[model samples]
Target chain A: MAHLTPTPVIEPLQDRTMILNMGPQHPSTHGVLRVILEIDGENVVRIMPDIGYLHTGIEKTCEAKFYQQVVPLTDRIDYLCPLTNNLCYALAVEKLLGMEIPPKAQWLRVLLNELTRINSHLVWLGTHALDIGAMTVFLYCFREREDILRIFEMVSGQRMMTSYFRIGGIALEPPLGFFEKVRDFADRFPSRVDEYENLLTGNPIWLMRTKGIARITAEDAIALGATGPTLRGSGVDLDLRRDMPYSGYENFKFKVPLGKEGDVFDRYMCRVAELRESLAIVKQALEGMPEGPIKANMPKVVLPDREKMKTEMEALIYHFKIITEGFSVPAGEVYQAVESPRGEMGYYVVSDGTAKPYRVHMRAACLANLQTLPLMCEGRLIADVVAAIGSIDIVLGEIDR
Target chain B: MALAPPITDLEKLKTHPALASLLDWNPGAIEGVKFDRDEMSIVIDRAHIRDACTLLRDHREFAFEFLSDVTCVDWYPSEPRFEVIYHLLSISKKERVRLKVRLDGSSPVVESITAVWPAANYFEREVFDLFGIRFSGHPYLRRIMMPEDWNGNPLRKDYPVEGYR
Candidate 1:
């Protein structure tokens, strides 16, 4: 067996090389990520990512909890796009039960998931710009992000940890006037994106820092298992929404944005373009919003309506049974993937005809995307390492989980 | 966004001539093939994973070039207590197939497919970290999400979810 220790390269300037631990607490590395960089003066020669400071043993914890209990835990896994995690887990469990969610639920899911994408991108833009020392853009980005968070509160009650999407459908019918509020934000969002572009897109300093920095070819990006904006920035025309449509994403009319250079600038442009496209999708969803039951018809799998639970004896018993003992999923496994803001987020869930999942493995996009940091960092200046990490848009919660 | 026609078909994958030929090429490597819930999966011997993945990636007709994920299921009381599953994808073909290799409960060890797909490095390490299933040829097979001196693989069924002794 090979030694588990990393073998550092003893190059010509070995004496000049020094290892720098970037962050377990530093602001720029995003979450509790510590990158051990082997540097020769300002140039990086090797990098090792030290993770797991935030490992909550969530996967192991899932094995002990019932299926529904796991959804809140999923939210904490990728806090940026918590709804995306919720939807992916719900879809996987629903597949096991062969449950068909109502058309309204599916459409609502597409709308909420798009909003999650926008919310996540807003944070990415704010922090990414802040890392590059563009102060005003951070404030501008947060202003818009606040609107999205408020909209989330309107629907899910909780701002960040929204365990909104349940196993069979959404937790509740969206509050009245929810569509109009989202519409008001969606109507004004394109110009906000333009506001961001005006601030940084054409600025020579912004261009210099982002245009060629952290560049990776499409082949290398794909080989490293990068997806979503990171892969799209590298000119890979793959979006799980368009390619493998789920949760009624196919019903809306929108474009799958692509970029050619696969650089920090291209990634920025791709995300900016995505912000516009997501607005378009949200508008389409609002126009085509279906009127039907929010939850699936399966009483065994889906919780009954509160109104019905009060009136009907059968509904009351079903509700009591489901609440006390979580509904059991079929003895099978399914892989459900969703196009999250970061990348292709997948949930590989296994059930053994039990209330608890036998195993639930999150195919976290951050973990895979973070692997390419060393590939992008080596042979580059230490300053660009921060830019590269920002461009990857990782939520270390997801990676460490 | 008009729904793209469904890209993956289990029936089509099961009958793919190239896939059939690959199965024929390695007579004893495959244990069984199953299509459940519209997904195609083939169970393979633990030792032949590298060879199987190589064929899956190299074959022109079944070019599963991307290794999406590597995970394990710990069936504690079952004879072969671990099942190492590999999710493979072909971007051009727009198809996905899972390859499963079951490892014995005692001394669970298998060949690593990092030779076939470089992306498998982190995923293999993660599997080893959580499941304590060692990859025989993995270059840096250390714990990924756990501390270096962690006591046990927390994912195994018998491993208590709460406190450690």
Candidate 2:
């Protein structure tokens, strides 16, 4: 039973060095991440991140709930990009059912997904800068984030936990002037990016803190399962939206931003460039927006419209059955990965031909990305550890779940 | 569009890149092959999963250099009660493949792929933590999501959803 008690993450190498514990509560470590660091003076000798403080067992919970009921659970995994989680879960389930999403639903998914990217990145940019001691950028980033939250509220009715996406399609059609509100934000966002860039891009203090600090090579990043800006910052050109092209992303045009140096600054720059590319994709989705039904035609799988349910007897019965018993999915497994703002967010769903899912495992990007922490920060100064953690952009809810 | 039937016959899927390479290396290594819903899954012999992963990663034609995810599915009251699934992605080719290894409930142990891809470190640890499956040669095999002192594996089918109250 010696192994029953967890081994200490690090052992002291020398008498000169001492161990230091940082945050399951510290603001800099992001959620409930506890880092055990063995340091000699200012230099870091070893770094190990201890997690599981936020564990709620969402996957175990999914096994008991109906397939449709799991969408809301997905939202709690990554609070920053709830819609992206919704989309990934929906796509995986839809693939399990072999359902064909309407063109309009696909396009709408693309539009909202990019907006969610911007929303997540804005929070990361603001908080990452704030972690590095730039307070004003936090305020500026949140200002635009407020607008994005308004857009999410407009679409999903809920601000943060937006389970707007359903297994067959979206929850409802966009309200009147929804496009107009998105268009207004899209039109005014570039200048706002410039505003933040003016504040920190060329700032000497920012550059001194981030450039050449917490660097990791492309090969090492890939080996450690790093994705999104963390891998892109190391010069790996892989974006799931462009490479795999799910949810009608092949129709849109955008560039996958790459960084030459695998450093905190490079990751920051990559995410900023991505903000522009995501906006470009959003504009494309709006310009060539498809006109048709917002959900698949499968009455058994998708919920019927309120008007149809009221008028048609079959629709009413189907609705009642779906609400009570839930639709049984085909017995199969499907892995659906999407290019979430932080990285490759994937859902590996296995169905047993029952109303509930057999196993719903979320391939959380943060959990993998967080593995690269020791690789980037082990030999660096203790202060640069903060830069490394911020650069990875981990959400503990996703990591623990 | 109606769903097409899954192709589970090993003979029909012999030409698939992943299966072809595995067959070329050692036909006995693969226990089964399935292509369903536009995704390819190959069941590998539990003893040779690590070697098969190394071969696929080093194979030039199908370079699955990145290990995307590793998970386990538990089927209780069955002989082969655990299915350890590994999702591999080729960054250059933009292709994906799944490898599964089945284990019996008596001793649910399999070789770790951390040597092939260090990324498997956390994923393997997570699977070990949740499903009570053992990954031989894993650097650290401790509970991840649950506490170290917690009793029994919670994700197993026999475990109550509400926990042992």
DockQ of each model vs. true complex: 0.42, 0.63
Docking class of 1: acceptable
lDDT of 2 by residue, A1-401 (tens): 65444445566889999989898888998899989999999999998888888989899999999999999999999999999999999999999888899999999999999999999999999999999999999999999999989998999898899999998899999999899999999999999999999999999999999999989999998888999999999999999999999999999999999998999999999999999999999999999999999999999989999999889999999999998999999898999999888898899999999999999999999999999999899888988999899999999999998
lDDT of 2 at A121: 96
TM-score of every prediction relative to native: 0.95, 0.98
After TM-score superposition, what is the CA distance of residue A203 in candidate 1 from its true location, in Å? 0.8
lDDT of each residue in A189-302, candidate 1, tens digit only: 989999999999999999989988888898888888988899999999888888788888777778988889888999999999999999899999999999999998889878
TM-score for candidate 2: 0.98
Instruction: List each model's interface RMSD.
Output: 6.3, 2.6
lDDT of 2 by residue, B1-165 (tens): 677999999998998888999999999988988899999999999999999999999998778999999999998888799999999999999989999999999999999999989999989988988899999999888878887777888889999998999
For B1-165, candidate 1 gives per-residue lDDT tens digits of 111232344345546543585666786887777667766678888778899888888887668878789999999898889999999878777777888999988889999888777789999998898889999988888888877767888888888888487
Which of the numbered candidates is closest to the native, going by highest TM-score? 2
